[model samples]
Structure formats: structure tokens, C-alpha cells
Target: MENLPKSIQVIFDKNPKLSELITNPRLISNSPFIFALSQKLNYSAKGNEDEYFYRIVFKEGSSRELMTINSGELRGLPTTTCIEKGKISDVAGLERVELDNESNLMPVLLGISLYSSIQNSLSYISNLCVDIRNHQILEGQARFERISETIVDIFNSIPDLALDKSLRDAYLSRIVKNNDDCYELYVSQREQLRHSLKGNNPDYNSKYYYENELYLFKDKLLTHPVFSVFERLVAGRICEIILSGNYSKSNIQRHKDFISKAESDINDIMASRISDLDRRISYYKRDIEMDRNLTRDGIEYHNTQIEKIELGISSIKKQIFNLLGVKLSSFDLLSQLMSKDEIDVFLIGGNLIVNDMQLTSDEML
Candidate 1:
């Protein structure tokens, strides 16, 4: 609060409603101001827009807190990301005002809060170590700026699990006895999965959070815990590696190469997936056309079969007429045999023998 200029504080004091906006959803939501603030902190590889949290709070009163996060804008919301509050416009005719100007109340308060939270959270997460068991790791979408705060929050929440530099490094690179390898095996599995799902069915779900909905997917076999110990350990180690300043130019170049290779691998997977999809679509389409052709051919074949059936029936009818004139008792007994399905039974049996011979011939071929 003291860090904020008196001029900004005065505007914030005038607007009590501003501070009330600080809640879990607001803190975690993807907004430009939050994104900018997260950038200011540099805690993780991701940015604030990609990050999410259950909730974040201010120990102080809501008024100052709102002003802090809002930064300089006195009247409405943040102008940094082009989002303004008050549902009003200014002299610019753009329906928004800049916070750098003290006339607006929203920006000034919001900016300060954003900065304060990031700085405090970074210092907080830095002090603690990581804890993991299964060697599983979870990656956040937020850039280093936003993720740093959440990492701190997670560390702050679970103070019991702690690790040092050596342990942290071990956790990141360690291989658990669990059959799944984090880098190679799991990555391959993810690739295989991504490959298997490459259709552009317009009616299919296209939500950005669809992938994150691992919990709702009935086919999904597993989902990462919101803050798994294994994930924490990996993150801690990675943070240490980035902050260490121990890497030479060669090592940094090696890391850059790894990133390039990873991106290339992903692109290759996607390309192959598209090609596979096109091939499958082609095959299915061809089969459909073939079915149409077969149907047209089948009409003629069916007509020919009907003619043969009619001839067979005619022969049976003539034989029955002859039998009616002779041995009527023996014929009545034969009629009671209930052998109407004899032809169908014989056809099924003969087809099985033909199918066996065809299979044997195909195998030999």
C-alpha cells in the first residue's frame, strides 16, 4: 500500500467497489492485466493467460487490493490490455481510458495488486523445495511469469513436503519403477494418442479446455492431480535449472536445440496424423462407392437367383402333383417332416466348407 503513490491511493479510496473484484475466479481468469503482471514476475515458462488458480486473496482491505492489481487507471479497468470497466468512454472516443493517466481509477489499483502478488508469490515459492513419489510431472500452460505465482501458492499450501538441490534434481530426472517413462515412453504414448485422433468431424467438440477435461472423458484412463507431488518436484528442479546461472553458452545452446527438436517432433506427429486421416477417408470413400457398384450388380444377380428359385419350385410342384396321384399316405407322412428350412441349413453348411477352402487357398497364395 505504501509503495503506491498517494495520488493513486486517493482515487482508489474514492472507489470502494474496485477492491471487491479480487476473487478466485478473477485471479485465475485469463485477462491482459493479469498476463502483464505475470510477465513482470517471470516465475514460469508460461504466461498469466495460460495459468489458472482456485483462488487468490489479499490480506489487506479490498479497496487498496483492487487498485493495486488494476495499476494506474482510476475510473475503469486496465488499459494495458485494452479492457476497461465502468462501461464508459473517454476523450479518445475508443470507449476506454489509459491508467498511466491518474484521471482513471481502475488501472492504477489493478496494476499495483498484480505486481505485489507476483513479487510476494515468487519469493514464497523460491524458499521451498519439491516433493514427488511416482516421478510423474504436470506442465502448466501459463508462462513463467504467471506460473511462478501459482507454484509459490502450491508450495505455500503444502509445507510438509520439502527437498534440497540434489533431491530436486533427482526428482526431475529420476525413473520410477512404474512402467511409464516421463520423457521417452510417455511422450511416445501421447504421440500415438494424438495420432489416433485426427479427424475433422465438424460436429465434434472443439473447445479449448476439452483436452483438460480428462476427468469427464469416460475413455481416459488417468488424469494428473491438480498438484501432484511428482509434478511439484519436476517443476522445482526445472526452476532451479533456469535460475542456477551455471549453464555455459554451450549448455544453453543445447537446451535451445532440445526445444527445437521437441517442436519438430510435434509438427511431424501432426503431419503424419493428417496424412493418415486423409488415407483413411480415401479408403472409406472408395469402399462406399464400391458398395454402390455392388448394389447395382446385386440387382441383376438377385434377379438371376430368383429365376433359378422359380424353376426349382416348379420342379417340386410337378413332383408333388405326381405323388398326389400315387401313395397318398406316404406323401402325407413326408409332408409332416417340417423340412422347409432344409435348403437354408444345407446352404450354411456348404458355405462354411467353401469358406474354409477359400481361406486355405488365400493363405497358400
Candidate 2:
């Protein structure tokens, strides 16, 4: 309290509750005239912790009433706001003023209220993670349903934090990475299971049971809800950020570079996946042809396995298409010039047509 500026100390002296509630406050902004003060708070609920970020903007002189501005405006600003005296204020207005005797303290109070709201939203997400993990203990369709619900809950929570673009992007990137890691882990486990099953006797009942297990595992892996959800969330966020029209030329260029790199990475990953799927299909086809005593069901199982592998290859191809679409949509002119069908053909044949000229995917990206 003693380290605070005279003006700030005066405000706290006048409003005793300000010092009591604003825990771990740090002076984030200061000027010769002390126009604003920002603080980052650590808020916790139900044993889950989240950051509560807020700022306060002071009026030029004395005898000024409290005012509110949209959270979007708060970005790049020196100060943030909170509520005062148990009153809740809207955090969405561009600029709205309200008369109050303690106008100097109102901005700080508003900042606190905003932080509390953000913390609550984060706590809700933490709860959802816990719920999903518990549900994963269940088997089969029930587990898949629970996981889908949790992902939806996360998507819904995203809009609540839209005001803080950096925070929202960070949270989303973390989720995507975690889900990708989980998908890889699941695939590895399935492969290990497949190898183990191959060591079993090729009797009719045993062969049928092994095939059934592999089919179920492969179906679940290929159709995992997280895969499509990941594509939508990632691509949607990338497009939103690029199209927001808020960034400088240099920042926009940086985003473009990122999109290009992502396209390259996706292409590499898709190629590797397609190759692996093709190898598996070949192996299954060979098993059907070479096994002299293979029953009708055994032959049918191998054929089904080949079909599933082909479907997986198609899914990987679609993923690349989605990523390339995102990259193209980032450019207004390119997006307008190319239709989805044109993009699909471009991806399929590695060639794109624009204004009577054909361009390779590499050149386009």
C-alpha cells in the first residue's frame, strides 16, 4: 500500500474494500499523470485456478463519474476496470458513463467483477475436463458420447472468452495439442492390440472374434468425434483471426506465414498417413489371397479390414483439404477466385486452376 502512488493510495483510502478484495495486485501501468492502473489477479474456485485480468482508467481530473468501455477496446489499452459497491456493470459497451459519488473507485471495482466472471468461466471448463476423464472410465459408446459432450461444452465456453483473444487462442491451441496427442496414443495402442491378435490361432471362432475387435477399434479411431471437432475449431479460429481486420500489416503477414507452414505440415502428415493405410490394405489383401484354409468369414474380415483402411485414407485426404481451404480462405482474392470443387480437384491432382492458369498445390500454398 505504501509503495502505491499518492493518487492510487488516496483511492484505496477512500474505498477500503478495494484493498481488501484485490488480492496480489500489481501496478501494471503508470504515467506522469497516472492515467491508468492494470492488475492481474489469481482467482480460484472449487480448487481450480484461473487468471483474473483487469484494468482501471482514471478520468483527467477530479469530479468525474465512472464510465465503461467495451472489452475489445481494453485490448492494447494501459488500464482495465472492475465493479464497485456490489453493483455489476456491462463489459460490452464501447463507452458508457454512469454517475457515482465514488467514481474514481468504480473502474477498479468493474475490473474485479470482470475478472470474477472470467474465472467462473475457466472453472467451468476445468469441471468439464474432470467430467470427461471420469466418463472415459466407462466402455464403448457411452465413453464416446461423454467425450463428445465435453468437447461441445469446451466449444461453447470459447465465445465467453472471446473478449480476450490471446487467452482464447492459447486455451484452444492447448486443447488441440492435447487431443492430437491422445489420438496418437490411441492409434499406437490399437496397433499393439492388432499385433497381439495376430499371434492368436487362426481357428474360425478365434479369427471372427479378433476381426470383430479390430473392426470396432478401427471404426472408433477413424470416426472419433475429436478429429472433426479439431479441424473445425482450429480452422475456424485461424480464419477468424485473419479476417478480424484488427491486425497490422506485419501481423497479418505473420499469420499468413503461419498458415503456409501449417499447410506444409498437414501435407506431410497426410502423405505419411496415406502411405501407412495403403500398406495395411495391401497386407490385408495378401492375407485373404495367401491363407489356404481361410474360411468365408475370415476372407470377409480381411476384405472389411481393407475397406476400413481405404476409408481411413479418405478421411486423411479430407483433413488436408480442410486445412488447405483454411489457408485459401485467409486471402480474400484467392478465396473469391477458387470454389470448393476447384480446391478439391486441386488437392486430388496437385493442380489448381485460377483465371485460366493451372497452378500446383505447392505453388498455391
Best by lDDT: 2
Candidate 1 has a TM-score of 0.23
Tell me each candidate's TM-score. 0.23, 0.30
Worst 10 residues of 2 by lDDT: 344-353
Model 2 residue 2 lDDT?
Answer: 65
**Whose TM-score is greatest here?**
2
Candidate 2 regions exceeding 4 Å error are: 1-83, 86-257, 270-274, 288-297, 319-328, 332-365
Q: Per-residue lDDT for 209-248 in model 1, tens only?
A: 2233222222331222222222332334323223232334
On residues 1-365, what C-alpha lDDT tens digit does candidate 2 reach at each position? 56555665676678787555543233322321122111111112244334232333444442223444547946444223334453533232223212122234333333222222323222333344444443332224353444345444544444233334444456566555544544443344344434443453233344454355345434543343333333333333332332232234454455556555544544553354356457666777887889889999989978887776577567656655653554344443233223323211100011111112233465345
Relative to the unseen true structure, what is the C-alpha lDDT of residue 154 in candidate 1, on a scale of 0 to 100? Answer: 36
Backbone steric clashes in candidate 2, count: 12
lDDT of 2: 0.41
Model 1 off-target regions past 4 Å?
A: 1-181, 194-240, 275-365
